[model samples]
Target: MAGPPRPAQPRPVWFEAAADGTIQLFTPSDSVKLRRPRRDPRASIVVAAPPGERERRVSVTGQTTVEAEGARDLAERLAARYWDLDERADDLAAMVADELIRIVRHPERVRRFAF
Candidate 1:
């Protein structure tokens, strides 16, 4: 017999490489912090928009290094990459700076699926 399926959750958060080689993650309260997993020091990323029914997604898993930095800066860089806009970069960056932190992970393992 097979078990029930698992629930969907956010996975493979984005993290860019800072001047230094480190990874980062944001807190629910809009605070930047390190998402260092005691068991799994590595990290993974799934860079695809949330899909609806009958949709598909592409993702990759790899090793990661957590970088320690102020939240504000990290958010902006992520926004710029995701949005690809230059104007109001600072403002937009500031908005999510606290929302996300940076993570430096390598593409060691990759997996894709359709739903």
Candidate 2:
């Protein structure tokens, strides 16, 4: 017999690119589902950096690879480089291990604004 459905686990948030080039972020929970959809190369991934008190937005865009795992690791790396936050790949992955539905995206759409 089949086993009971497993409960959803916490996962790191990630943005994805659609065929139309629109961006979408997977919630920490909704990532439990797999085989949902892979990002299209034609599109781009936009990562919005937290704004400072002065008021400004930082965005980065670069080519990305598609993968079904290793999302948290990616997040950690991004955080370190962009946010100057030191994070471990293992711990990052572990934090979202329960909802380890990984997908890779490379940012190609980028923009910034300062006030």
Candidate 3:
């Protein structure tokens, strides 16, 4: 038997590859994306390479778990990676002070394609 289809809500996110080959993502504690996974750990992520002569893409399918304790650290790392956090350390710290969630995906399979 099948139930009602789940709603699709897509949003851009930054990700980092962990040494263990898992993907790490950070989101606000209030985000639905963070909440929904608790009910269903299954998840997938797709990333497309910058536009060029050929289009390249990678997809990962796996299960995710919320790591609350690591969220702050990961959020700081992400902020530093994407922005000059050191220049405005106070602001960055204040921003991350709000509840954050760390979502770690254990990759079950990975697929890459180029066109």
Candidate 4:
């Protein structure tokens, strides 16, 4: 459950890159993502360059921690960052209220690759 994601089952999740350089995302409290990482604190997140851009990507391998605080706020911020929340306001509020865990990864190794 550490380093680059399992290529056979890579999950595409929305994430926020914190100013402190940690990668974060919210998941249901009982999600496998939370379960696996709890049993094994090693994890990695790979982000590819945006569409219409040159081929490049970044991979971060790190120790992960699940936080109980700030999940709602983080969710709101991430939703706005990645979507036009104006249309999904209700959906956002509803999902934010669900039991959620914040997965924060503190990077031990960060690699950048251009292909």
Candidate 5:
């Protein structure tokens, strides 16, 4: 979710890019991140390589929408992708039990550089 525009308001979120080239993330329906985006559809995501890795960065700027569908599915998929859920399956179950909204970003521009 993207924070409101102001001093130091820009932030990063755990988002996944589907094969269709759209970004998706799940957040509680009441998240503060949903507040500003609902007011303004503009948003962006920036990704950088790990600290010890070579310098590579990707940035995407886009318009966003909050949707009611696919939050649980996305959450489940991401949990598995990023975690060894064999020992924490219940944690994922609990997370998906909440009222979530899927934040979708439709990219209008993308920038990438590696050095």
Candidate 6:
């Protein structure tokens, strides 16, 4: 496969799905998770709703592309979603500009389950 190999252990992450259905994820530029995708453009993402509810989840197997140019923009969106970035926009933007990496996954298959 041209994608990243399954990790020895699962690493949970926060992700956002766009209206177009592609998934967006942000991680540190030096993260192992980012390394795998850079080596191989394939990736899989699993997301669960209402945390701790395994039965309600969505899994996406796809191809990923590193989007360095848009990393700062994506980071800003993420910060707005997860934190109060209004007052600290400059700081947050600087941090993301320096260390963040954006991974955009184009879904090949999507599976959802409700149990």
Per-candidate TM equals 0.44, 0.36, 0.85, 0.87, 0.90, 0.75
Estimate the lDDT of model 5.
0.88
lDDT of 1 at 14: 48
Q: Per-prediction RMSD in angstroms?
A: 7.1, 10.3, 2.0, 3.5, 3.7, 3.5
Candidate 6, residue 31: Cα displacement in angstroms equals 2.8
Ranking by lDDT, best first? Answer: 5, 4, 3, 6, 1, 2
Clashing pairs in 2: 62-107, 64-106
Give stretches of model 5 more than 4 Å off: 1-8
Give all candidates' CA lDDT scores.
0.54, 0.47, 0.85, 0.86, 0.88, 0.78
Error of 3 at 65 (Å): 0.7
Best by lDDT: 5
Please, what are the lDDT tens digits per residue for candidate 2 over residues 20-113?
A: 5544343244542332233223333333446556766645455434454555554554445544344465555555555534444455667888
Model 1 segments beyond 4 Å from truth? 1-35, 52-54, 69-74, 81-101
Which candidate comes out best when scored by TM-score? 5
For candidate 1, what is the TM-score?
A: 0.44
Return the clash pairs for model 4, or none: none
TM-score of 5: 0.90
lDDT of 6 by residue, 1-115 (tens): 3555566436866577889888988887887777778877877877777767556888889899888666677777777887777788887867775777888999999999988
Clashing residue pairs in candidate 5 (N, C-alpha, C atoms within 3 angstroms) = none
Q: What tens digits encode model 4's per-residue C-alpha lDDT throughout 1-115?
A: 3476544337999898899989988987878777777777888889998899999999999899999998888888889987798899998988887988899999999999997
Model 3 reaches what TM-score against the true structure?
A: 0.85
Q: Residue 42's C-alpha lDDT in candidate 6?
A: 71
**Residue-wise C-alpha lDDT for candidate 5, range 75-100, written one tens digit per residue:** 99889988899987999999998998
Clashes by residue pair, model 3: none
| Whole-structure CA lDDT of model 1 | 0.54
For model 5 the local lDDT of residue 88 reads 78
Predicted candidate 1 versus true structure: per-residue lDDT over 1-115, tens digit per residue: 6456433345555456546443444433433324343334555556554655566665666675544456556665666677757666676745664444344555667678875
